[model samples]
Target chain A: MSPETTVTFHTPSTLDEAFALLKEHGDDARVIAGGTALVVMMKQSLVVVDHLVSLASIPGLVGIDVREGAVHIGALTRHRDVETSPIVREHLPFLSDVYGRVATVRIRNSATVGGGLAHADPSQDPPAALMVLDARVRLVSPRGEREVAVAEMFRDYYETVLRSDELIAEVIVPIPSATARTAYLKFLPRNEDDYATVAVAALAEVANGTVQKLRVTLIAAGPTPVRAEAVEAALEGQSPTAEAIRAAADLVADAVDPMDDFRGAPDYKRDMAVVFTRRALERVLLAQG
Target chain B: MQLNVNGRTLEAEATGLATLVDVLRYELDLTGTKEACGVGVCGACTVLLDGRMVASCITLAAQAQGAQIQTIEGLGDRELLDPLQESFITDGGFQCGICTPGQLMAAKALLEHNPQPTEDEIKHWMMGNLCRCTGYYQIIESVANAANAARGDR
Candidate 1:
């Protein structure tokens, strides 16, 4: 059995206070948002901490807005808010659909955009979509602030590039061009609420019978959200014929490195990744009226 | 810490790690909220925190300190059953009865959010509240019936 530990909780109304609490608690402190994932880890003793500094009380950390050709989503914005936001629905409806499929409505109500990114689970839904959308997370700390592309956020399974003192302040997603169609496909063979066995997100712009631009990303297929760059390279400049799409989608089989779990074996997930990628590609490229 | 639970302000001495479910059940004797899969996956501990449905088992009491927390106990009693409770009983929404409170709370949240939700919307909203008895069809019917009853469509 693990040793018993009494935890202290702090709800700091400002980043300065939160930073000071982090300094006071040092390595024993952990930043909490929504507490959907972190609290579960705390209960199961997967992550033990002496102090939990909450960002809920902090102002200016919640809301969504379109500015400078991008959707600026506050770190504290809940998944449900993003799913239901008219702006997100109108500007990034595919993203809204992806957020709506996360876990369930109850979980979405409490899980925040930043918290989910900070949790950095490879099986999560948003990372693949965000990567395909070319979203970037603005991170803040007592030291200063910086932005990192969503494609570079994850380090490993359940690990991120976030420093202990740094918090994700906002996620800025560039609105895709009106002509670029996007699709997100999650293979949930089990419960609807369960994580995807292998998920795929694809965005493409086709003109004059040629693929002008394309981006593809996947989840639950690797240690981090895997970008199907090879697949993108093969199709971006070519006509998205069925043969071309199938050949490009087949490249994802060699791209992902999945672990064996109840969801599927490594071999099975790789196949599903290819299958879903193909399906998503067809939705964006060929299924149009 | 002081909590605004079910429209009443109460003091609780739960530790920082004590989840809202723990405080509501152990300290305040509001045992209507259950904990099955203690990790937020199972919606057995579903509650309304500041009018939003959340898994109380994963929400820290400290996190819910100032929020208006509503548990199953607040959803009316034996003398006056909530409309959802009435619908569940009338529609046979449960078999083993383990997931009833959560089903009711989640249904209540759904009806509050969308007073006239379609069958698809109800199913989507109540997807998190799992029923091992496979009483899903009845649960869905119950929520749909409740919505109809609220809107005088029954």
Candidate 2:
């Protein structure tokens, strides 16, 4: 089934107008920012909506600013902009690289940061990258506004904790500490544009030859972006040695619950998750900070 | 809806769900943009939206309402050819020619953004525009040679 022939597209110039349309249409209205994900879902009949509330005309929802010790990216900022933004490149080059790894230049030109996070596709790269950076998503509704950690945003496949009346306003990614080493390894053995079989993002810092801080996150290996807490628990405060890293990486095999697809079988994905996670950790943990 | 395509403004009677590819090919009769993978993976349906390359298959007609849409027809005509088009013919950038339009448009975008691209940059930027003929070497050469010719380095 395709979209109904008489779907109404509404371009709201203000967040208040968008909220009103969403509230009026209820389940039939979807907030479309870039249309990279929602349009495909509509084409595939996975989601059917009668009204499309586009945020394209909204002002003040598109910019990249560095302030308050974090980079505040507006909800409507496109992926290509984020990938090439000088502010992002300087403060968070690892994140810039991660954003650049998304589908292709064409897709990146149209996909947006807020839309990507709001879509909440578990296989996407940004969620894991943002999780490793300790990013927070700023949400707004007619009632009030709040912030949710990137790791806690996802509930399941294509599902988020966003309420029906709520909309994502911005994504605040606190710049990683200068001494930290971050790595994003996407295990896409097939097409460069394809999603990863298992993607890993890790940020680590070593002080006086011991692991001071470590954050491990993985995508495409579970329903949501999986944070390897057990691995972190085992490695934090421990010496950054090859044997210890291997032991900690092996814990990812039990942490992830990957689904079988053309990319790989469940067991194969689990194995690749461990392998990629270990490589990513080694790149950050064992490297000189 | 009003669409500005190839420097001409036209009216299209389409729904918000109608894709830009469908509008260009059916409503406005611009068939140069093809849709191979309707899910936005393939580059067959690529077009320039406001001077930037985008997947027309996944982009809605409503999305291109106020943007300048450029198709292969706008690149060059029979009277004259764009540098990239001439390079494709002189450099053997096509075999079956289904992916040629997309290849040219994607290359055109790259050249516009970066006038002189290295071999690695050419490959990296054009990797998404797949050619089923497996003539990647010729395609990459076409883009590189086009850039050089544009800069009078040939």
Candidate 3:
């Protein structure tokens, strides 16, 4: 669209209506929740669509509630709400902090959690936190609905496994264990609002000075949020110590494959990934102690 | 599309893909809300859609259908300026002034939800509203001064 392309806009009040609209239009239709990322892409002519199916009219899809030990955040819930919600603050304060750090208050007020996740930008702050929390994204289509782990959501840079007809409906974050300690550290070498050069999210359960459980994740260090499985493998049953943490974090250097960009070179990002992972794990371990 | 802008219901014809900033600037002629960065990074296009400050440059005009839109023009009339507007003028919160409208709106949203914001809150809220001229201390002080004035400390 050199000048501008006028597309048909569809406001579907119900999920079924939205599904039908998407089904009819297929790949030609695009679903927009807050339109923060999609609108920028559309303006840049990165994503051109003939039909825009807006989910703004859909009710019962913008509330955050606690259900069966999980925080059920409607896909349309604005980031501001998530950052300020008492329910989220009480149940998942780490998630609240993560959302609060995205962009600034103005952008967060309009950007939805579902929109952010579907945008699938690895540098975004939420994915690393969600991965550590084992969050799941609820996707709906004309065919059916299914839940996919947020960690498994992104396939590559600016890509996800979501089908064209499927719309992200909600994000389900399982409440962390009472004894679990979590930390999300975003390393921003540039300005505050800029995306992280390398971010880390770590959750661990330490009992009797031993590592009972651990989950370490990183963002903007690779094509997707890299789950540092090797890091976890090194310290799963070992004692928690400065030396052990460093050794385990070193494994992150192997797991990430970040592309060279303005943020940092691929090798630089890999190195910083290890540094951030160690720091994140140290914070969580200290909290456990 | 129908929009309730500045407490007035206005009717305008806009494309489905047209952003709210363009609709406000070109169609409605509400150029007070400037558009510096078409992307959402800069808050030059910030406006309150239903009491929440949003990047209107990235917001679709159609998404704003039935929502209450408030720009800097809506915040104050020609005769009486809003407290933030007054504070901005008094404290010299802006230099070139492209970011002033967005800064005012963001500050307005902050004070609405949080009547008494700490310096950190003001900074966090207004971080998106970048200024190329001022060093940001003046903007922070302006918001703080507005908050203090609103709190009857003036």
Candidate 4:
């Protein structure tokens, strides 16, 4: 750790000011919202930056409201706010379930939605559900803003497609169909709040016992959140019978690209991903019929 | 940086890099809040920033500016301990006592938000604050008892 060097901090009240700071510092600056992940890295000297721009004071970046047909969560909105938010629960309960499972109430209370996505922790819980929910993250910079689907946001481990000067402004999740049933199942061997060894998040629509629509995503199965494209395709129009679901669940094994770690061996995680994916599908499918 | 801590405005020097726990313990000398794990996993550094319980170790002092931060030192009055504190003592909530301050602050935030929190609620809310010695039943009891005392049901 560089004990001698101290970072310069700026609390900007507006997005323009914050963007200007990021533009000025460019690669040397890092935007911190909730600081749950960034500060820990900073403390460990893993991330050494000359300037720290805090988004906490930005008023426009702190809210959970409905916009159009989706729920718009400001980048700086804390996880706890999202978890307990009546709007979030009512609009997208899958999102609330995912956010509620992160770490604990204390970590959730401080970790911001934008910050969590920006941090790009693959093992974290939110991204998987956000991916299944077809959420889009808004990234703003001095130039302008652009939206990236949650599935396409992450580039690698602890990395995102976000440019150095860009800040995550908001997350927009289109509300699911009123009849769609969603399930988020996180396999945690240690404790309830611990990071999932392997987690499955899925939403399914059943029309006359046929798979009308399905979206599936996996966590801790790869460097980035893994969208189970194969599984989704397998069950899209098939009858959601146990036989069909079992065949679809097997596809998750190949779709996931996990690595060996404390959680499990890569093969073990892949296997568990298949099991949990099947479990999640069963839960959602059962909820319908 | 200037902060409204525990209902009193105080000035503290914090580098842009300093965390809220850092400024509170080192600069402001509010050592009641302890930093056990540098990460957000441990609840030892829990503090209330604008009435919301957050991990002080990860929260930047700069981000917490213009907000009210309450630590363990601010929980009780000069004359007597807060009812929560009294409950902790009477219910045998502490053994090592290292986690007491953070636990107290977390409990305070919980009760303020959800007065009369059920046992399930208390367990869920206080999950992050680890009490290595107390095995948690006592801490849960302490919070429930304190909630009861707050409502004058004790």
Q: Which predicted model would earn the best TM-score?
A: 2
lDDT of 4 by residue, B1-154 (tens): 8988999998997777777888898889998999997788879999998899898888878778888889888888658899999999999999889889999999999999899999998998898998889899999999999999988999
Candidate 2 reaches a DockQ of 0.67
lDDT of 3 at A150: 95
Higher-TM-score candidate among 1 and 2? 2
Query: Candidate 3 residues A72-181, lDDT tens each?
Result: 99999999899999999999999999999888887788889998999888888888889989999999887899999998999988899998778888999999889899
RMSD of each: 1.5, 1.2, 1.5, 1.6
Please write out the lDDT profile of model 1 over residues A1-289, one tens digit for every residue: 1122488888899999999999899889889998888887778888888898999999999999999999999999999999999999999999999999899999999999999999898888999999999999999999999999999889988888988888999999999999999899889999778889999999999999999999999999999999999999999889999999999999999999998999999999989999999999999999787
lDDT for residue B135 in candidate 4, whole number 0-100: 92
Question: In candidate 4, what are the lDDT values of residues A135-190, reduced to their tens digit?
Answer: 99998888899999999999999899998778888999999899889899889886
Off by over 4 Å in 3: A1-3, A287-289
DockQ of the candidate models in sequence: 0.65, 0.67, 0.68, 0.63
User: Which TM-score value belongs to model 4?
Assistant: 0.96
Cα-based lDDT at residue A3, candidate 2: 61
Clashing pairs in 1: none
Candidate 2 lDDT by residue in tens digits, A35-61: 999899899888888999999999988
| Regions more than 4 Å wrong, model 2 | A1-3
Candidate 1 DockQ category?
medium
True contacts kept of 4: 0.71
The 10-residue segment of model 3 chain A with minimum total lDDT is: A1-10
Model 4, stretches more than 4 Å misplaced? A1-5, A287-289
